[model samples]
Target chain A: MLFDFEIQGGDFATAGNASSQIKKILKQLNVDHRDIKRIVVALYEAEVNVVAHAFGGKISAEINTTEVRIRLVDEGPGIPDIELAMQQGYSTASPEVREMGFGAGMGLPNMKKNTDEMHITSVVDEGTTVELIFFLNQTPPNH
Target chain B: MIVKEIVEKLNLTVHSGEAGLSREITGGYTSDLLSDVMGNCDAGKIWITLQTHKNVMAIASLKDIAAVILIKDLKPETDMAAQSETEEIPVLGTSLPAFELTGQLYELLK
Candidate 1:
């Protein structure tokens, strides 16, 4: 199955809709509970990242018998240093965002921790694109 | 244990999602960081936080959390209350701080 969702920037009210929908679909497909949790966690983080930082974004998810692949592309002030951004305590969110209990600098790290394979690419002035792949057959680490 | 028991014991005000007061509670997670709760909270747990936004409800529904307790007498946003009603995950409130409520809850569950 293939799913596509649009993410509106700074729209906290509607954020996580895509993740919720994807989770429901995964459950309907009878995906493992553990796997569903991992995927939803990663997707929710990515979705919130767009809502927090980007102008807008799109999420593309492909699910098959073997794996689930999700790509999030956001047109925003792209990450200048992917390595720095990946650090657990690095965040550029505004104070208002932090007050809402987001922007803890844990979003990207949590995304990486939940997904089996993760890739990120960005341009200075354009946007960032993140690809996450999870193999359905393998047991997650420390499971 | 179920959510209603905690609400009664802790003196938590049920602001919305009364339909979900009967939901089961397995554990509790105390965190204001949305990502932290998202990353660590397990299914059937009660989330303790000060965040009162609609996104909180979104996270609760996605994680299959039993209920949410807003600390420090905070209340949920309008959209949050609406979503709580729709999802049937109770949005509870407490006058006590997170530390105190969590401690009492720990005793009750443990």
Candidate 2:
């Protein structure tokens, strides 16, 4: 199954809408509880990234029998330093965002920690695309 | 312990989602950062934070948390309460700081 959701920038109110829908679908599909938790964590962080930093974005989630692939494309003031952004405690969120308890600089790092495979690409003045892949129906890995 | 018992013992005020009081509390996590809780908090845990935004409820629901306790007498945003009702996750409040409340909850659950 494939699903798409729109993300509006600077809109903290609806930040988790996409994650919420995806979570419901995963539960209905009877995805393993551990995998579902990781998926939701990664996706929710990505969704919040778009809401907190981008102009707007779209999320495409595709679920197959063995895995789930999610792509988040955003129009925003793109990250100039992908490596730095991936580091924990690195963020450029506005003061207003920080005040809301969301800009603690853990989003991307958490995203990487939860996904099985991830890729990110961005243009300084244009946008960013983040891909997260998770292999499903597998025994939980020791963490 | 169940969420209902926690409320009674802690004197937490129920701000929304009374139906969820019956839920079980397996553990507790205290963090003001949304990503901190989202990334690390386990399911069925009770969250203690000062964040009152509507997205807090979103995380609480998605994470399958038993309940949320807003610290320092902070109240949920208008839409936050509504979302808690829809998600059936109770939002509780206390005048205690996050530190005090967290320690108390930890002692109770342990």
Candidate 3:
């Protein structure tokens, strides 16, 4: 199954809508509960990141018998230092975003922690794309 | 324990989602950080926090949380309560601070 969602930046009200939809689908598919939890956690973090930082973004989630692949591409101020941004306590979110109990610098790290594989690419003034993959045949690694 | 019992015992005010008052509570998590709660909270837990936004309801629903208790008499944002009703996950409230509410909840669940 393939699903696509459009995300708007600073739209906190709809930030996790995509994740919620994906979660419901996974439950319907009888995906392992633990893996479902991991997938939703990572996806929710990524979705919120787009809302908190980007101008907007699109998410494509593909689920098959063997794996789930999700790609989030956003047009916004791209990360200048991917390594620094991946750090647990680093964030560039504005004061208003922080007031919502987000931008605590945990978003990226939490995504990485929950996914089996995570890849990120960005341009200085352009945008970012994040790809996350989870293999269904294997037991989810303990986090 | 179920959420309705907690509300009765703790004198918590039910703000919305009263339909979920009978949901079972396996545990509880206290945090204001959205990501922290998302990453660490488990299903069937009651969440105690001060965040009033709709995203809090989003997290609660995604995590399958039994209920949300806003500490210090904080009210849920209008949309948050609406979503709570939609999701059937009770949004509850109290005048007690998080520490006190958690302490009392811990005693009840323990």
Question: What interface Cα RMSD is found for model 2?
Answer: 0.8
Runs of candidate 2 with Cα error greater than 4 angstroms are: A141-143
TM-scores for candidates 1 onward, in order:
0.97, 0.97, 0.97
Q: Give me the runs in candidate 3 sitting further than 4 Å from their true place.
A: A140-143
lDDT of 2 at A42: 96
- Residue-by-residue lDDT tens digits, candidate 3, A27-137: 999998888989999999999999988999999999998899999999999999999999998999899988889999999999999888999999977899999999885
Worst 10 residues of 3 chain A by lDDT: A134-143
**lDDT per residue as tens, model 1, A1-143:** 89999999999989999999999899899988889999999999999999999999999999998899999999999999999999998999999999999999999999999999999999977999999999995885677
Docking class of 3: high
Candidate 3's TM-score reads 0.97
**How far out, in Å, is residue A142 in model 3?**
11
Per-model chain A TM? 0.96, 0.96, 0.95
Q: What is the lDDT of candidate 1?
A: 0.94
Q: Write the residue-wise lDDT of candidate 2 on A1-143 in tens digits.
A: 99999999988788899999999899999998889999999999999999988999999999988999999999999999999998899889999999988888899999998899999999988999999999996764664
Top-down lDDT ranking: 1, 3, 2
User: What is the DockQ score, from 0 to 1, of model 1?
Assistant: 0.94
Best by lDDT: 1
Worst 10 residues of 1 chain B by lDDT: B47-56
